[model samples]
Target: MSPNRALQRNISFYDATNPQEALGGVVQNGSITEANFLDILGILLVVDGVSPLRAQGRMSNHIVSRRDVPLKTGVYNIYCDASIQISNEPWIQRLVSRFAYREKDTFRREISNRDRKCVISGIVNPESSIQAGNWAGFKAAHIFPLEREGHWIQYDYGRWITDMDDAPRSSKISSSQNGILLLAHVHQVFQQYLISVNPDDGYKVVVFDLDRFGLDGKILDPLCRSPDDPHHASDELLRWHFRQSVLANMRGAGEPIFEHDFPPETDMVGEILAGHYGQERFDLDITDRLR
Candidate 1:
């Protein structure tokens, strides 16, 4: 059987951090660690259900060594091991309600005006509906996530924000260029890193989880990508988000998947603190929400 087919057949047993443990029976020649294992898995995920030739052409730019190499070869050559390091970083997503920022309304308005729809689902927001004050089921999601504002500032990620006039002086994390309009459900998946747009692959939407929204392989909406539009979402930010998604879902054993829904009177904080990387995540969530 072909290597790809062999890997696919035993995908359930595959472990990202220790590939040799699971793939030893199938791939006997080389040392496959988390680095190469994730690279291979990423290619498989990107090319799943896609024709080889088409996927190759689409992922050409991601080729590390030879631009002419086959899609699989190129993907295997690229070092995706950085994702492993990223997965170990102190990143966290906020689950509880956050303190409202005064500038958030302006940020939402700017994003809604620029995108005018769910960029992933292509669901349009009609002007008539807006005039009637019926704006529901839509949200402006932060690509970098508000919970990571500390990291954003420390890393000076605000340098990528070209449209910053509307952002608050304290931080450019609220820039419209860092936001995207998405359906309420789509927003949830995106925040959880279950879905992402691969900018290098012609902005193709990649679903890391079950594609219940029929969004896999869909192109990002052009409305949010026009070069002439000053408020268009940043490709740099999109790329960062895509990498995060890959690490969260493709790394060995993958990052811990948290349950966001809480029952009434449940100790949400206590539960979160008791989960994986709980103390760090809880601390970050509390710090950002109160800011």
Candidate 2:
């Protein structure tokens, strides 16, 4: 959502920092980073489950080449430290990396322990990648987001503990309750309000298309239910996410939404579904499949 820029500046527009400042660009040469060719909207744009990598190639200069470093057992394109935290490379911005490292260390591990793996990424062996911090392309993303009672809420959920013997409300705002481990691409779209996870009757994925671009779609259901952990995706949190991504915005708000949580599927009327060789409408020949 484009909040009135007149009211705020840096990072006010969704996960975007600033339209004028197309961050995340690393210049190969002094003259060109992908920043020269993009804006914030273009940076966050996704098409068919992938961001536009073609534009990145178009800006690549022949003179600017990357030096090859010796491989260090990388997985998920991340390398972890001994603490199972994804170690940050020099490339990540200092200010941002500081907080992210904390998130990577604690958030990733906590959610993995509770949910048992990356919920959205579906990595069966997420543990193997954790020790190496070379995760299998998953991110410990905040569900409610990092805004101050605006597009999202600015709650520091990192320090939340599972033992709710003291304060029950603390666990409610914890990332372990509302946050999720999504694939990098999935996290990107999620941060930008492109998709949401619905965890009611069954796990369901919802996508939003504000521009009518038909980018809306679904992936495999996340299917997470941690009975042991007090901090899995709460139904309240899921509805909040849906309201942000669907109901209050692009998709119809009045639409009766449910994650297949309604009453059990009913069989179609047997006689009406039956086929008849005779012209008489009531002369029915029901098959076992209809039973």
RMSD of each: 9.6, 22.6
Give the residue spans of candidate 1 off by over 4 A: 1-103, 165-170
lDDT of 1 at 210: 55
Q: Which 10-residue window in model 2 sums to the lowest lDDT?
A: 89-98
Instruction: Assess candidate 1 and give its TM-score to the true structure.
Output: 0.71
**Scored by CA lDDT, what does every candidate get?**
0.62, 0.37
Give the per-residue lDDT digits (tens) of candidate 1, residues 1-291.
101212322222222444344311112111222333335344333322332211111234332332322223222222222222222433345442333222388888888878888999999889898777555999888888786777788888898888785566447888888889899889877877878887776787877665667887688998988889987889999988887776565544455566556678989788878887788767766676676
Candidate 2 root-mean-square deviation in Å: 22.6
My TM-score estimates for the predictions, one after another, are 0.71, 0.40
Per-candidate clash tally: 0, 6
Scored against the true structure, residue 284 in model 2 reaches a CA lDDT of: 18
lDDT string, candidate 2, 46-129, tens digits = 333333322212122122113222111111111112112111221100111112223535566776655555565455545566
